[model samples]
Target: MLSLTDVDKVYLTENEAVQAVSSINLTVENGEFVSFIGPSGCGKTTVLSLIAGLFNPTSGKILMDNKEITGPTEKTGYMLQEDYLFPWLTIQKNIELGLIITNLYNEQTKKDAMTLLSDLGLDDKANAFPSELSGGMRQRAALVRMLAPKPSLLLLDEPFSALDYQTKLKLEDLVFSTLKQQNKTAILVTHDLSEAIAMSDRIFLFSSRPGTIYRVFDVPAEFKDKLPLEVRNDPNFHLFFQTVWKELEKVENQNSNTS
Candidate 1:
């Protein structure tokens, strides 16, 4: 339920102006999981910041549920690559932080937080500090904190990049199941093609700097119902990966030639 129309973001410097994103238009429907994929410096994270209302676009508009996003809204939740848990806070308190910030804490909030931790298989670690948990557990705990506030829209910026391959796969399933059960609208920025295909209903491919939508792919049927690992084994998985890889190569070549 988020839409961006003809969005552009430009940054000013002492010598010149840098355009990070240009003429980017995108729509994410309710209950849909969308992922943006591109090479480094493609402005994918810029788009997420704009959607989160962390900053205003230089031009165009971003709408959430038909209303313009003026500034950071409570209706949006953001999870970053790092868990960013307060080292001093226990897992239960970390989740509670969201509720506390929103001025919504109560006995029911505590109950819900515990239930979410349990669902994510972090129940045993609820009393553990961030320093005591593994990377994957910390990420899960961060996600639980983000979702605890029950925001309608979730923005994830490469939330799994730090984990090992096996942990990443398991976390992907955990995130997928959690989002489905909650019916949250999600937009994730990821470098992993397989992760995007396995997790997103639609994948948006972006060009390099001054990024714009280069291509959009609706993942094939084989991947539509499989786990991230299972999707890797699908015959067409390699085909999809090759296609996107080539598209990214084209951008690299174009940038090199222009430079």
Candidate 2:
């Protein structure tokens, strides 16, 4: 449902222009879960910003459902590394903020939002402040807030990075099931290879800066029906992980040599 064609992003400094990404062409089908992984400074986040319409590409175009994305649209939701919840607002209000901002705040929407909050096991925490919740709970609340607006596309930028390993794994399972249940299309940017392998239907490996698609790895068919945590226990999990890890190592080595 989303595609980027020959996209290029260049930042102009006083002295010279630096290209952040080059010749990026990719498509994400409706309800597909894709992950983008690469070495640091490879512009994964830049591509995300372009898709979110936070910045315009220097060339080419990005389309969602065949319509060009020129600016931010309510149909897309972005969940970042940090929860970014307003400390003063209670959980219920924070989750409804998006709906309120979009002028979609009404009894039904509010109820639906509350229902989602409850589904994520945050029902009792609705009256709590951000500072009162643990990091994992806060992130789960963030997910509720993001989903409350009912966005068709989700852009997750290292949303689990800061959490402990156990929390991260648990959140991964929750997000995987929730998105699948809702049939929402998602693109995740993460440095964690195993996380990418377990959670994605496909993984896009990018090259070093002035990043371009280096390789695309399709997750094994057997893993598709499993949740993120379950996928990790499959016999072939480590095999696929090793393959991606080797390729990522190559990408990093190439960057070092070039530098």
For each candidate, the alpha-carbon lDDT, in order, equals 0.89, 0.94
For every model shown, what is its TM-score relative to the native structure? 0.95, 0.98
Model 2, 94-186: lDDT tens per residue? 988999987788999999999999999999999999999999999999999998889999999999999999999999999999999999999
lDDT of 1 by residue, 167-254 (tens): 9999998888888888899999999888898788889988876788888888776676566677777788889888777887887787
Provide the global lDDT of candidate 1 against the true structure.
0.89
Q: What is candidate 2's local distance difference test score? A: 0.94
- The C-alpha stretches of model 1 lying farther than 4 A from their native spots are none
Best by lDDT: 2
